[model samples]
Target: MIVKPCIAVSAAVGLTSSALVGALHASGPGGLPRGARGTATRGGQGMEATGSGFDLGDWFKQAFTPQTAAAVKKKAGTSTAKKAKAPSGRGCTDAVLVLGGTGKTGQKVVEALLKQKRDVVVASRSKESAAELYDASTPGLFVQSGVDVRDEATLKNKALFDGVTQVVSALGPRFGEEGSSSEAVDFQGVQSAIEAAEAFLEQGDGSSAAPGDQERVLVAPGDSGSDERGPGGAWQPLDDVIMGGRSSSAWQKGVGGGVLERQSGKTFGRWAGTLVTEGGGFCGTVIKDMPFDATGYDGIRIRVRGDGSRYKFRLKPDTKLDNTAERQYQAPFDTVKGEWIEVDLPFESFVAVKRNYVDFNAPRVNEGPAGGKMLSLGLVLSRFGFNEYPNPKYTAGAFQLDLMEISLYKKPRPNFVLVSSASAERYHRLTEEERKNDIPIVALNPGGILNWKYKAETSLRKSSLRHCVVRATGLIAEGKEGDESVRLQMGQGDTLSGRVSREEVGSTVAAALSSSYSAGKTFELRRDEAEDATGKTPDFTSLFRGLVLDEDRSLASAGGASLPLPPFAIVQDPPPPVTEERKQEILNDPRVKARTAASKKPE
Candidate 1:
């Protein structure tokens, strides 16, 4: 099959080839060791080495003999103490350094780590910009300034990875941009990160086969400030205590907004305002100089219950002065009145409102570094009495808007990531236009970037690090109309065609990164089926199960009782020496001659 030949090229570089390659390991497709061939004979068969360094007995001992804390401490002697004590005044934790943390997918990855409460360090050219792109309110966020992955100097900085264990490179050049081209960032930068990791492992910490190396110290979120908040802590009360007079003086009577506490530690806001005339404007109590930094978060989220009234949520940037309309960003929201509902107001959805009038022509509210530094947040009840609820029946009395939790959220990032890359097959067939204009494509011809990417994949496969490689046809964020669920079609030949959401692509990358089963395997990813495309996530477990490891494929094809794990060794004790009569019979067997002949070929 064409796939078998293609698989051979990939498998040669540490991936799994066809059953033909498995033949080199043992007998038949299963590669089962038989009679422990070539062992020295004693009274009985002696144990033989298979040159794989696979010591069965040692494997069992390591697997069954659990290493208790005492055992680990004893093994390290006093070196463990020295490792635990970081240099005085060094603020570092076992962090996952996310390069390109301000990018779309990069930011999401950071958010996911924060959600897991894992310590994270964002590495970018500007730490300030990176911080603005992340939720500084999230306790574990630390910014590493002046980190250009392509720069060898930065990569060689010994302290760069001081507490870093995992380094995720979402590094890619911005589309159609000049500086930071793919050759520089994606190719060379990735190589630099890998080399730096290797150097760090060699010089800074010795390799130990433990799950997470003991030398890497990590900080928990609770240890930071993320999970801590209370009344009088972040939220504060408004001045004047009256509503209409603050926003406008159109009404004879007014309303007030304050906090109400529930027995379960949940607090709701109390907004009761009365408008006597045609119209009234009331703005709620404002919060100033919020202790938390909301960098990187998408927008503010509020849970509220109101009297079915239309309300406006306003945010003031750079100033704490009350009732200021100029330079304020506002988004209108409707309340359900009786039942509490959560509303997400993304930063992009907000518009600038100056001098109590909307500026429709103003640019999208800036969310840049300085733009995200919000000075105040409050609720506005502008135009609610006459313009909105003009029926007089529901217009004049007290209007209430209850507020529950108010915080910020970003699009949740997937735990694992598997980039859906362009298939190697595409490069095999060059169009007339491709041949004429695509110099880079032609230069990398017949293979293109696929070869470069596969080279990286081969490195990963050869390494002990756990990883997954997903080859995708094309990626799009939004599917064509009527398509909802992200479909996963797997093939080895890379002949599949279609596009999938950038969302699904990012999600798949995240999924593959986290799945143990995905390690040491490659997959062709596509999502062409339009029937089940309701934006539903496909069954990832089953999808990943299809990309079984080579070892797993071999075992499945062997078709017998499941092999027992550890204590289950590869190289077995040699069998007893055959008698002259038995040896004569074995020598006469045709299968033995074939096996013997096959083994004699130079490896």
Candidate 2:
């Protein structure tokens, strides 16, 4: 009797009666093992199924028949042939939350991570007037409950922390919203969110907060808090990167200090200009004053990359969360070019007496050794010893340097985020290979990307960021949708719609524009970039010019009241077709009346 090894046996014949699957030792075409795992297989006439298109289970079982098992086992080690385990637990780091997670920048960061298979949690920093940044695209990402972020317990979600990483912030002010004090998340509830993150990390619930490697992984380092966000306000860290390593011997000349230069590699200028303000006080850094607390965390460390140029770090006059006064400190560092270095500032540096830090228009509230103060790290480019000074050789100008990273590490390379693989896959299928890789096809959508080549597959499939831009210009040159190829460029907009496929390009000119525009109605949801390239900003002139072209055919069909000629020319009303009474009677039958009527009405 011929025996079949790969297929599962019927209930009547259990495993006892069934044979085990076997594997071949040799490599097959495409470098796959000859069989599924180097397991034993039952190979005979019953299991001689053809190769290609077999189900995964069948492929595994059939390829591992006893006839080839010994060869496979000997050729490859038992461990190398083992099937890898699947990833489990939460999708992202433990409680990977974003304060402004739904905001334009926040969404980008979140999506970038999510596309990398990270689970994300999101929340609006406030309760009212929030933009539509938050929406349904979110699946594995979680949204926090309620608007108040101060209450740690409220933001604590086990599902988030079950497999979470960090708390991030990408929220920013909407246009014209910056005037309101609420525009700055930095001053208000952001601190509350930070406190919540601290609580979450400490209770043994956030073990996934840190990442081990710089590239293969990114750490959570806890949540982020923000403020001073605006159109020109810039991303908070960017501002810090440019201004953190400032130094000077004196105040500006206008304010009675020596000259300062705005170039790179140049240090202090001539003469000992009092580090103090002309009024003998502190006035340089953007500082805050109020009852302060660091909880139990250590001192702040500023991370930046600089050429082997000297830089001075400073502190603020009033530590109050509301105080704007800052004083310079005497710490210096000769930084190497293009490498990250950490500068640690102990709290004790600024606590000294004689309180010479404050020098500004604002007078001292109370005298005796100005008690209220805190260190605010900031840079000073122009000052007494900065540029044109007696110390002529001192160099530091518009520093040609880029800042890549920054953080307040507690100790030497503090493991702010620890990484452990709750689950891992040995082979991560690249994007391009995803489709051709033949994953579950039914699981994907019609227009879904078949290729998963990071940027490789991108070039293969139709869309190109550069081409998307170039084609947009091309389509614009065409003036109207009908005049252009409409080849999936300028995706559906607020105007009408497109089929999202060739067949859907509105069978007619007017239909294509009117239909496709309506399809991509949510284009406005995007902020940093336009929903559709044209909508980058609303311009009726371009829209009119682009849509209403020299060829007014499309507009006319949509009842535009403009068009020199119809899409289809008039037939000149051909002489009334010859009709006889008997012939017309048969065509007029009610059963198929509509077609007969249309046929009789005109050519």
Candidate 3:
């Protein structure tokens, strides 16, 4: 009658007194679990102990209690209920995009989104891999192959952003991966995404569109307002400056400023302005605030679509016209109505002048010390004859000049540009002395992106997309990091290195889609120390919460600069004479036949 429950249980289990004592030692007193050290009540007497916060009685109950299916389900229901308490419509959506979906980071990002029950569109260069990665039977997951962001035609394709709400680019270069370099995937790829986002927002799916539904995601560059004029320097309209003429009838407007207007078909900037040069007065607009340093550029270029009129493309060394130190240079070019033509205004072709009339014989104004730095550029309706006096050329009436792009070029500037994540300064492995010496930074090297990181950042900043730039540390493929114990760590100063699972990076990108707070932010991520042994999906929302949201370039604080890249080299070669005997000799080689046979072997 006085037998304790523990003694009775031990007897049932066929345990001796010594064995019971040993089992009790392992489970602690009264069969309570380890780390259950605290105040306990036994036989109406209080007992004190010190250890974990967990109560001993609660631990014992959990350990001894046998759970039924109903009870297990009830616990799961409790967790589900807790999850339901989160903000409504804050979870994953039908359309999420992973741009470099086949890449290490991109592939992980795709999986993370799918696990959250969100539909994902995986975009990569290879169609087969993209299609093969995920099964079509799984609802909401899709694949897009043969997509190259560096190519505008592919980006402008309507199928690219179909029903897509968010885009996460894990697109980047790995060592030895050919064709997809940092420039192609990181910088240029990002820029393309930005452009696509702008287009998507502008042209919502031909139905009732909400502002939130219209929004998409991607990242690009930033502007310093120093050195590079940024994207703003790409086109400076006539409205930015003052327009003056002898005739009051002359007026100008910055109309149709299209960066990339695919809507309604036409897609080019049209600088439509009226030039009525009555009373023999010259009409023109001065772009005095041209802050760009045109150093290394051979000349300025303008794309014009205008009425057949002789116009003077002018440049000034100084900003002020009142100062005697200022010198003006003008080049006259004839335009064809309705036809777009590029007019190149080289410094060598410019005629220098002290007034509106130029002295063509005066040694071309010496181009000055700032030969390439043309501070002020202008478009003018100049007089027909510049012999001894200025005489009016065209009739005084309505005139228009359609301007597409204005740029400074040595060779023609590329229509598109690609950049690398290694462009970030901290990523540069080079020392200050090496950077100063202007060495070439190879993309395959550890810190290859320093030369182009800034460029990529700048491109993103100039883009139309609302973006979240997450610069991650060294990426580790899934199995490479052992088990999936990914604890996201965010910081600055480029201090964190080691390896982070690509899947973790993907999960973070997927989480970013749900938060508008992530927009206009740049942060760094790395994997923390191991947390558990078992493989489990990380808490993406919690990881995203750790993002710094700071725009500061972490690398700048580290005091690193990009190494100078070598100029483009042209290697010309004469064509080899085609000979049938040489071709046959190569084709009939035994080694070639063996290699061909080996390749043909079934996989």
Candidate 4:
């Protein structure tokens, strides 16, 4: 399909921004941030926010002190407001650096800065054949600097940190890539970025450096101060975005935006100490991580908007305490759903002099027995209201923010640029405009980004993103001398209750399915009348609920049984094969075993 020029342009510029490009991991497809999120009710679609540019130096000056300036920036020179060409990335720092940029969050940072017209460089080892990679380029937004992240030189290359002020790392290990210990990319990557910044700042001559002799780190912090910073619309400086003012209730937590329901003219949200007005705001957090350098800079700033309800800003910094424990930060905001309100936090508000939230490395626990920092930001729609009587008429309308612009310096920085796109800059640059329209199909393990087997296959042109299922059965091909395929899509627990009794064919079908669905959402088998079935298809929705989300799938044929769990499912960790004894137990479960037995007595 021809991508509209407007969207293509926004995506082009956004993807090309260094901030955006760097934030993206080498992960594929959903590899990096693109400044927007997918909303299901909206058909997984959204409007674009074109990021524009600003003067970085001006903003930098306004926000930092000379000491910070000397430590972060190498050039004592000036920033030209007239869209100066970005610093030529000629010299690499002695430190190896990883740019973990991209996704909705990183996209905003990159495009906002790029609107200021910064040259963006993205690095991820694309496994496209050399021929394919060259042809698959997205111009304007992509300057492919192929750097192997696993290599030490990636960090030590001095050319990376030229004119670099602060290192704002938006790095995090993605869904499939992190090893048990590789999560350290955050702890270690930030340190390396610091080393590079230092080398860049101290390059050429032994210049008199920073006042405190410490490098200022630009990390996304977890909490804010707890003091009472009284006000109406002065913006609350906390990282909490809540669903409803946080109820100590577990049932309502993951229900999306169900926390606050407005009935009649009055709306009531409940929490310990949050109050609401026509323009109140709230933020609840699901923090997972934070940086080591906690107190060197100013407090946190976040962008917010919603039907104004009294909001409570919660913080969960990782310290000696368990992860779920939360301390309230100053919660204030005069919010209107349609606008982006900036909340500036003076570190003083978030300071809990006695209780600090910092846990360097804690064992990861489910209910969060394993604690980290408050890396997550949540929202609660209502809190601290007059009455909970006739639950007020609730409006479930949706609210969204294009980007959160956080200025960490004590004040705004002078000469800093706020770059944005004509439509969320750089999203366009992700795909090869030359090839985006021609993306006939994409394989799940395409380029082998995830080391799992049973590659997922789907078409780009279909309305339903979950278009088709692809599998390499290595099947015993006896069909008219070649290979052919048939795809089936059904809801969870819905099954094709075929009464065929062939155990071999049932097992083959199970094998085929196992190659496709790993540990994913629930899905049931359905018999589509439209499908040209070689035999009778099974009833889908009515039979397959319990078998959907399992690590393995069990099916019961008339005479024998088989289990089909797509390779993606984690059945008995990749090693130490499951003993046949356990396999029998799986098939024995009445809920899991599919009720199809295949043809007329083929046993």
lDDT against the true structure, each candidate: 0.42, 0.25, 0.42, 0.26
Worst ten-residue run, lDDT, model 2?
A: 8-17
Tens digits of per-residue lDDT, candidate 1, 1-603, equal 000000000000001010111112221222222211211101111111111212222221222222411101111121111111111332554334455555443544455555544555555555334433344454544444556665778777767766544445554432112233334554466566666665662222221111331211111111122332223344444422353343321111122223354523454445565634432344344455543345445567777777887776767765442333356777777777588787877676676777555666654443433455666676666544322343222344467666556666543221112232443333344454653333221222211233444444444444544445566443332112234555566644344544443345445655554444455566666664666555656655557655555344445342242541111112111123335564454344343344344444343
lDDT string, candidate 4, 333-419, tens digits: 445655546665443333221122323232222113323233323333333322222213223323222222233332211111111
- Find the 10 residues in a row with the least total lDDT in model 4: 4-13
Ten residues in sequence with the least summed lDDT for candidate 1: 4-13
lDDT value, residue 254 of candidate 4: 14
Better of 1 and 2 by TM-score: 1
Q: Tell me the tens digit of each residue's lDDT in model 2 across 1-603.
A: 111101000000001000001111101212211212112111210111111111223322322221222111112232222221112432433344444443222333444555545444444332111212233344454344344333344455444334333434322222112121121222223334344444443222213223221111011111123122111122112121233333323222311132233224322111122232222122133222212223222233445455554554444444343343333343334467656565654333223212333233342221113433333434332223322232221243334222322233321111111100000010122233442232122111111111111121112112211011000000010011222223233311221111121111112111211121121111101111223443232221123223322123345453244443223121121112223552343234232233223222321
A best-first ranking of the candidates according to their lDDT comes to: 1, 3, 4, 2
In model 2, what is the error at residue 182, expressed in angstroms?
A: 65
Please provide TM-scores, in order, for all candidate models, with all chains considered together: 0.37, 0.20, 0.37, 0.21
List ranges where model 1 is wrong by over 4 Å.
1-94, 115-117, 174-179, 201-420, 425-451, 462-464, 477-493, 533-535, 550-603
Instruction: For candidate 4, give the lDDT of residue 301.
Output: 59
Return the lDDT, model 4, position 107: 42
Backbone clashes for every candidate come to 23, 83, 17, 147
**lDDT (10s digit) by residue, model 3, range 1-603:** 111100000000000011111112211112211121211111111111111122222322222222411101111111111101111222222244455554434545656666755555444444333333345455554444446665657666655655544455554432122333345545565666667656763322311121332211110002122222222333344421234444332222222323323223323433345444444445565556664455434466766677887887877764442243545777778789888897766556677776546665554432465544446666676545464455434545666665554555443111111212221444254455543332111211221233334455555655655556665544432233564454566544333433344456666665565443355455556666566523655554445444443343333332132422221112112123324563444344343333334333343
The local distance difference test score of model 1 is: 0.42
